[model samples]
Target: MPHSLSWGARSIFKNRYEFKVRICYLVGEGRDLNFWTDPWHPDGPVDSQTSIGTMLSNIPRNVSVHDIRSDSDWKEVLNSGPYGELTQIVHSGLFTKELPSYPLVPWYSSLWFPGHLPRHCPVVWQAIQSRLSTKDRLFFLGSQRDSTCSLCRSEPETHHHLFLACSYSSWVWRFILLRFGYRRKPNNGLQKEEEWLRKTFKGKGQIARAIRIAFSATVSHLWKERNRRVFEEKSTHKQQTLKDILDIIKFKTLYLKLQDIPSEKNIRISNILGLPCFSKEKSSRHCTWDPPPEDMAKLNSDASLANDQGSIGGLIRGSTSNIMVMFSWNKAPETISELELEAILEGVKLARSMDIRKLWIETDSMNALQIITGKCNCPWRKKVTLKLLQDLLTSFEMWKVSHQWREANQPADYLSKHDCPLKGIKILPTTA
Candidate 1:
């Protein structure tokens, strides 16, 4: 009230403890007076004739002085405090005037204000709550017990049960922990779970991001699996859930690792070879199979790109139309040359698998075929295609390259597009 106190006076009391004391002094004495500590007023008294005086007399001075001052100068004192630095003051009720209709007691008393949740956590939180609320309503609408697990139909379906505590959730968490090499048991409480994740992944590279992605993916997958079980009476398996986690981890690892490679050559090599450039020092094993007769071994390869996924499928065949060896691999590549290199690698891998003593390799990619046979050298394509040819040379006694029209490569094309199974290969198959 004393002209709202000058900015200088307020600035001088910037130390929180000092500002609190000044607020108490101002509330008790306005500008012209001082507090009276006498028997008529067991507590301290403000000015003699006002409602504020009566209110001040009722509040026990033995109580926290800060609390008393906060109640009296709620708006002015809080406004003077730093915006996000007033958590203690706000929690002490100094800013309740700004939050009308909010509960008198703080919902989460230990939580700090300006409440910065993890990035995107509020969206996740609301999505989780909305899903739980929907499940609750659905249960009640069916005249069923609102407490039953929607997925298992065997236990209460609170957020903890659905996500962490129930038998179904236990399996889901076990799958996640095993994939991450963690051995901790999953807990039901949200805070406990969050703490476990934070402590376990602290200082691990990209692991915290992986954990968050896995957690969110688990939430989404489990919700979908639960809905499937409830609506379609479908059963979800632990193995399938584990597969989902691994698949997500693999995809995220590849995506983030590729982002770090600056050179187009290294990226193309990674996409075509499915191996990181840094991993070139590591040993790789190739499959070897019995070669067909010298005049009969004919290798066919095809590459196809779709918006969602790309693949190269190839096979070696004999003059009698007997398939000698076949290979198919899915690759995540952005460019046509990457796809072509992937196809050539598939051919080389197939040639190795068949142990083709004499080989006539055919491809729909004429440029790739030209590079492989050394008729041309595309500086861009040479590094990867040369690597493939080098690997192929190690297994075959003789090899020739021929360019075929895309339409002529029907078997590999059909297999690339539809995964048509090959027949008549006597050699044992091997995993890549």
Candidate 2:
């Protein structure tokens, strides 16, 4: 190995004096060994295992393991305090066994999702977390401003009151709910409204696409309208605002080219909103969802990081484009690369669990795909991710993970961005 290496490579390894000292070695036939220097003890060496000075004692620096056996009597050389632990071990025939190396931590779960999960997902997620800059929050931060609802001006502005309790916003919400065919009035607060959003919108299907876009649009436009009223000193009428929200939701829903929405839902929303039939965008010739070959399944995975937290989501489809599984998880990692790698690994695990032997995996992360496919050199900092990719590769007889366009991976993208109500690994359409 030294002879074949270039000068720089050779120089790098030449000074590699630091080796792992964290291992405990098993005792074998200790024929050729140095007791003092070797890390063969279960407990680590004392005093750095250096040779004792001449003033200390006459025990030779190169004492062999067998040399200690000269005095076989239990009370003499063996029972001497220093060597007693080793004697007990030898008597019991429990010599050295090196502890196993640390494997990759298993805390990560992959979430695969599409780029447009919910339109402007980050903004809506912030709304859910009460991270938006409502007036009450600004006042708390020492702003010399009235902490009043921008729309209603009847109560102090807050995440909950602005989105839920204000009379003007309530009218808008009631109108949209009526259009959504929601018969019962909304519950009294924001959390309940959020629960409704989750129940109505989350799934890997066409109906899910419609509701998710509407939900995201409502959050976004409401925030935008509030900002306009406060910052621009202008406000649109409630009817005009509704039209804007509808147009935005319609634009998003149109691009998805949803094929599976029930006709009754289509009629109800369209009739109520007084809009044309949902427009359909042509799928790109080069970038569109494609199924794997017969007798195989394709797994598409994606991940997103929001507010210093990470999540993963994925979709598995048969050759006919029938979804067999979809999954998502909220993760604590703060980086996109780790989340992306985790999503792919979890997709692989999902397929294996389904007994799907042949597979084609798709991800929208170029960096992650490159690392997994060996198209580029792995960075030293990504060693943990690289190990995980290696483990994933070895698990399937016929499998491939490739980078696909975000345009083609909508379901996975949606899942990565949307917080799933379920925990851990989940299959889709789960019963309550």
Candidate 3:
């Protein structure tokens, strides 16, 4: 129906375009997803119900994915024998927790660099990318009255002007720099200041780290003050802002002192690894074991080599500080470190099933700790061990695997010298 009555004639495609992508229907009103037809199970489709060796029928062809509600409803839809067990197998898949399903920002690595504050990094990262919701950005996105700078009102509010050229921000920077015994006025614009500060902190020693911290803190707080004025209709004095800048730098600097930054201006291009320790000590330290918290369990593990055979041993202790379980796994001849990792893997698997909510795993092998913690990268090491440990840590509510000196882990050491052990977690009651 052409209301304008202006078109004489037109020709279009005779057929519609076709696509073959499967739509993953999110489970909703329970009316759309077909129970048998849709491939909703994590493993595979449950068509015919015979896939899992179940002999069954009479399920409505249009039954929903979430058809089971109560025990009676489940019994009604799923037969008590073969079909019941099949449904039970796939039910867990229907409600499995999904991982994050969002696009990640590219500035992620830049946000978590050494000396960056966890709380302020995202905000600063946004500002660095000029993606912050500054007045100009808001106005461009259809915010009418927010187009102008509130403090100066001289120019359209932009990231550069708000953070760099604004007289109020400049004054705050000058005041803070003077307090730091810096009589000079820093670069006046955001890009210039950012570049200069990056170059300035490219030198060696404590002064460079201190200067970088102050610069980042100042930028973060000045933006905070600007945001407060814009949204909350309030303004803190320049001196107060200066004090805040110093306090934040001091607090965040306590936990972030990793000098991973490269000074060659080819910064962060490559991950520089520290040289591994090759020196062997003649005498070991005499250290005693320490127990974990009462509600937690501690797992100590060791791997030893004897007569061209690798033996892995570990022990788990309950909150009462008594041994809960001990295990030894016979492995083919491998490096001592690899065997140590296998022992730890066994210990972690044991702890998860022990009814304890928290676990503190200890290993005398520093190489194992370093690899697990991501402090050192070793391609020659076992990647499966690393992946398993990472997954276990995330699944458990609380767990920590750290390096313990050989002196502190005597039980695991003694067990590693044993002859043979089946590959499993030993289930035993409290014993002497």
RMSD (Å) per prediction: 24.6, 20.2, 19.1
Residue 273, model 1: lDDT of 27
Positional deviation of residue 149's Cα in model 2 after best superposition, in angstroms: 1.1
Against the true structure, whose lDDT is highest?
2
Runs in model 3 deviating more than 4 A are 1-110, 177-188, 203-205, 254-432
User: Candidate 2: where is the Cα deviation over 4 Å?
Assistant: 1-119, 270-432
Q: What's the lDDT for residue 157 in model 3?
A: 82
lDDT of 3 by residue, 141-203 (tens): 787565878667688888888785787777777765555445656545665676666665564
TM-scores, one per candidate:
0.32, 0.39, 0.36
- TM match of model 2 to true structure: 0.39
**Model 1 Cα lDDT, one tens digit per residue, 72-155:** 353343354232232233333432112124554221211212222244344345444445554566566885555578666787
Residue 7 CA displacement from its true place in model 1, Å = 53
By TM-score, the best candidate is 2
Error of 2 at 399 (Å): 28
Candidate 2 lDDT by residue in tens digits, 222-281 = 888999999899988989888877776566555454444457776667666554555344
